[model samples]
Target: MKNINSKKLLPINMNSIIEGHMVIIKPISKKEINKTYLSWLNDSQINKYLEVRHNKQTINGIFDYVNSHRSRENSEVFAIFTKKGIHIGNIGVIYDKDNKYVEYGIMIGNKKAQMLGLGGEATILMFEFLFKNKGFRKIFNGVISKNESSWKLFESIGSTREGILRGQCICSSKKPCDVYLYGILRKEWLNSRKKYLNILKNIKIKNG
Candidate 1:
């Protein structure tokens, strides 16, 4: 991975906070790492699609991972919070400065947060921050083909099905699965932002 030159990035608050109607994204802190967070990583149901599921998770290791992201110039991780300030999940991005693109992964660790469209809200907020604020040209997301909900979340937000790598990943099923690649160019996101925004709004209404 290319190291991001801090000077090359546009000036933005290190403590940047992105707010949506249902969820918020902000830099995660040590205080947010707790028993519940640890449980999420260890839970088979929650981490089934996560690469981290291959290894055991420990409190110390999770803390170390978060700290590493803090110090890494090319990447950052943020806690996904609800409007009520509940820390339900996490989202992270790694920048490829030379290519002017970003790739991200997210987890809605809290079961209560799943299937409610909050993930989509959180994703859109992140995309808005990356494309509009950070000036990234494209955003890329990859999901195990079995994780239909995940890829569909990206699609609902206007991402295109770019490509697939057959049997690229070993999943929790103990078998290999295809990795579905999805992406959205900055121009495409800009053009369809409003339409998807309304779709998400209606989801909130229906689920509310």
Candidate 2:
């Protein structure tokens, strides 16, 4: 089997914030890792499709996890904040330098913030930043098969359903769940930027 070296020694330089009309993503800080953040990981419903749900989470564990990524060069974690400056969730990326690609994961920790399309806005912002600013060739995302909304959101951003990793995740259901791999090339996203921007504009206007 060919080894996939996902980590790189180069820093992501996540100092600048990526902003959308509805949300802004900035590097996560130690101050943000509080009890509420801890609860997001431990909540069964919140983490139903997340691997972190497999283990019980504590404040210390959450801190350690956040710190580990903070100190890593290839990994970046960002706190998702609304235009009102409320921190609602977190998104992260790990650079697969060898493959010239990036893998991302996201979670909307605040229940009140869920279903408002904030996650979608954050995702578009992330894609634009990584593709236009970072010079990455591609971006990848994976979703549990049962998470229809998540996968559909990714598709709306022009990511293709690349493949399925059979029984890759043991979900909260205690049953093995297939993982849906979604990927988008930088050029493809760039080409569709106008269409997506229009959609985003409509969403903003509608929401406001």
Candidate 3:
């Protein structure tokens, strides 16, 4: 992705902290990719709902793909890691130059990481970075009709349903799957932060 403006990347001291336990979403670094991540990508359980599930993927192929896109101005990918440093998944934002909007995509490569609120945490952090740091005006996302959890996550964060693209995705069975569009504008997101924080609070209470 385009290097974040140098001024935007300046180190700043923080007095307040968001209290919670979840995956850490940070820019993808060379050190984060390894055999473990490769294996996670190949796992059928993790790739079940993903569009790129094909025959066994090679490590070299994965490396080449990630490395090739590292410098692109339209996208930014982050490796999701737990507090203990275990790699759990990845999340990314793709800016559509013509549309002037960014679309988000995320995958929990580790099955065990699913439904732990980690995805929501990573998504919130990414949204903040995109809006405050990257100066994005709006964000968009598409979720497979069958992926209820993903849809809920987006909805819980105040993304409005923009309609569905029927039979837009082709799965392994060669069957068409519907995709639901969700979007949130910068002002909408800022206004809804308290609502999202409440959702997080409820999740913590339930888990406790």
Q: Which candidate is the best by lDDT?
A: 2
lDDT order, best first, reads 2, 1, 3
**In candidate 3, how many Å is residue 103 off?**
1.6
Ranking by TM-score: 2, 1, 3
Clashes of 3: 0
Query: Candidate 2, residues 1-208: lDDT per residue as tens digits?
Result: 1222222222334676766678878877766777888888899999998878889987677655655565555567889988898889998888776888988899999999999999988888788778887788999989999999999999987999999999998888789999999999999999867767754453321110
Clashing residue pairs, candidate 2? none
Best by TM-score: 2
What residue pairs are clashing in model 3? Answer: none
Candidate 1 lDDT at 113 equals 85
TM-score of each: 0.86, 0.86, 0.79
Regions of candidate 2 where Cα sits further than 4 Å from its true position: 1-12, 199-208
Candidate 1 structure quality by residue, lDDT tens digits, 1-208: 2333322322222457777778878877766778899999999999999988999887777766665555545567789888899999998787776787888899999999899988888887788778777778999989999999999888887899999999998999899999999999999989868876654452321110
Q: What is candidate 3's lDDT per residue for 1-208, written digit by digit as tens?
A: 3343311221211111222356555656556667877787687777667765766776665555454344445565667788787878887667777777888899888778888888888787767666755678899998988888999989988899999999998765668889999999998888877766644452221110
